[model samples]
Target: MVDTPAPGTVRPGGRTARVRETVLRTAGDLLAQGGFEALDLAEIARRAGVGKTTVYRRWGTPGTLAADLLDDMATQSVPRADTGSIEEDLRANAHLVVKTLTEPRQGRLFKALIAASLCDEQAAEALHRFYATRIEEWAGCVTDAVQRGELPDGTDAQRVIAAVSAPLYYTLLNTGDPLTEADADRAAKAALAAARAGTWSTAAPRGRPTPNCDN
Candidate 1:
């Protein structure tokens, strides 16, 4: 199981909200400028104008701090597109991902956070939740497509949405090649094809129960 962030991590409103905004922004700036290695609680507190004791007591470690930053980012994601066509919607989602991955500050910050997730359990859980949040936001388009008869009944919306961006993420992480609009378009088309092919609609075979590996 994943550990939760500590108290005073990110309050919802009022003056505490403003303080969190400033602190998260400062932390993001530092993370983008340098990487996970540069996340110092005292420095973040000084730069963000918050108390060092508050930062240390709230986050306790760099991994927890990075996790909180990721959580904040997940909450700030843009709403998904509803273009009346699954084709357009998936493409839009893909393009939006590419845009976020290619933008200077956000791109570097995302890369840094991904690196942090690889080595830190807290960061990994937060990152997983972050992606889950974004994927759920975009899954609506798939559900709408099914309702409109554009896709098969009982289609797995979240899986389809995840398929659309999986290859793009692979390209971003595995290859040094610059992500382009063409790449986004291709990924969107491929996922759409697979969805239409019942790749995500098939149910388990008769009497073939799913094996439980958690024992």
Candidate 2:
């Protein structure tokens, strides 16, 4: 007798993965074209050539599907830059963010995801997880800089990393300003300056140290 795989344990590159890829691609295409409201499971199954039941069973709802897509994106995101100098690493990170947000399809997809997150609790959680993953990946750069004495001791690595991308995101979301390579460089430089100036330090306050309570 042939053995059947467990319900949720399909091997990588197997039939399940292929189905998932097709459905996600179709979903992404629809999202880029018409945002979150355009996501319909029946239409997704039709476009992906998968069974409607399969799509529904796997993803359940539009919000859940969007959350799954974000999870996939986080998994597939590029690793952080590890250049010797923190400035170079941060510049690379800023440039990458600009490149992603400026790409036509990806930009639209991101906008749709952000919109979905605004209206859907599940999508919001997934969006938060996505950023957390990306931030943790890049935090290594700050830690390395601190170890090399380029940044002061007690620097908050995640804060420094967040600083690098904050302005770029603001440009993308808040202002209608075009994100240029120069802007990317300037963001990285500004974050590096602040980090070097101890803006993100986690050290004790300047006034005094805590008194030892144990007697």
Candidate 3:
């Protein structure tokens, strides 16, 4: 008898992965075109040339599907830059964010995901996970800088990383302003300055993991 994998499990590659890739690509296309409300399972299956039952069986709800997509994106994202200089690394991170948010398809897809997250707990959780993954990856830059004495000891790496991305997201979500290289540079500079000024210090040595900034 053939074995069957559990639902939502990631396969290295095969027909299962092919179907998933097709469905997710189609779902992302629909989302970019019409936002969260457009993520109909039957439509996704149709566009992806997969069976509606297969799509439904794999991912029952739009929220869950969106969450899965976000998880996939997190895994697929580029690793943080290790440029040996905190300023350069932060600037690279900021520029990468600007590149993503300004790219036509990616920007619309993100807005759709954000809309889904606003109304769906699963999507929200996945979105949080996505950012946390990104922040954790970038936090190493700050920690390395601290070790190199470029940043003060006890600087909160995650907080400094989040600060680098925060203002860029604000411009995307709030001001609706065009993001330029200048904006990216400024965000990196401000966060680096803050790190130098002990703005995100934990008041303790860097032996333990710093407390999460959400508190």
Candidate 4:
């Protein structure tokens, strides 16, 4: 009963797309303003000017609505950078995270979504998928670096990319520290250093051909 269309099934500029956009927009606004506890399907339908029955039929629960929102967010997320330098690419990734986390509306929206994931299994799975998508997208930076001989051949691209964001999330969720551009730069630099030191390199026991870092 998810509102999101199946892959390759959504038509551009159609009524279904319009309905989804309106409903998701209203849902995001509600989450940002009042958090997950305040997201009501009936209110979303009313605010979006869509039929309650349509909302109820397509997205049966708050968790499904939140999961759908996360799906949309992942689909619309920014593409990774290709600056020909691993440092620059990682910095770009880190800065983008900081920008999203520092923006008032987006910051609150993400917090609300994280809260929803903490309490709802459906939302949690969607949240995990969202991060996985983002990480996989950015992992290209590391793989490209490896191809260009900028990183060790066995470096784990996804792990390196995750390293760039882990500290930022820790600050956001635990440290109560204000995230700044400096923090982003430092994070990227630390990840780059660790990557260069082969911290994420996969070890091949004894004599097996080393697996491709891009794998």
Q: Highest TM-score among the candidates is held by which one?
A: 3
Please give, for residues 1-215, the per-residue lDDT of candidate 1 as tens digits: 98874754647789777877888899899999999999898999999999988787777888988898999999889999999999999999999999999999999899899999999999999999999999999999999998998887778999999998899888888987899999999999999999887788854533567989997
What 10-residue stretch in candidate 3 is worst by lDDT? 4-13
What is the lDDT for 104 in model 3?
99
Per-model TM values vs. the true structure: 0.89, 0.89, 0.90, 0.89
Q: Cα lDDT of all candidates, in order?
A: 0.90, 0.90, 0.91, 0.92
Candidate 3, lDDT over the whole model: 0.91
lDDT score, residue 12, model 4? Answer: 65
- Model 2 C-alpha lDDT per residue in residues 89-164, reported as the tens digit of each score: 9999999999999999998899899999999988899999999999999999999998998998899999988998
lDDT of 3 by residue, 81-160 (tens): 99999999999999999999999999999999999999999899999999999999989999999899998888989999
What C-alpha RMSD separates each model from the true structure? 5.9, 4.1, 5.9, 5.4
In the range 1-215, model 4's lDDT, one tens digit per residue, is: 76976432343678988898898999999999999999999999999999999888878899999999999999999999999999999999999999999999999999999999999998999999999999999999999999998998899999999999999999998998999999999999999999998898984433578778997
Relative to the true structure, candidate 2 reaches a TM of 0.89
Query: Considering summed lDDT, which 10 consecutive residues are worst modelled in model 2?
Result: 4-13
Candidate 4's TM-score: 0.89
Which residue segments of model 2 deviate by more than 4 Å?
1-13, 204-215
Q: After superposition, how far is residue 162 of candidate 2 from its true place, in Å?
A: 1.0
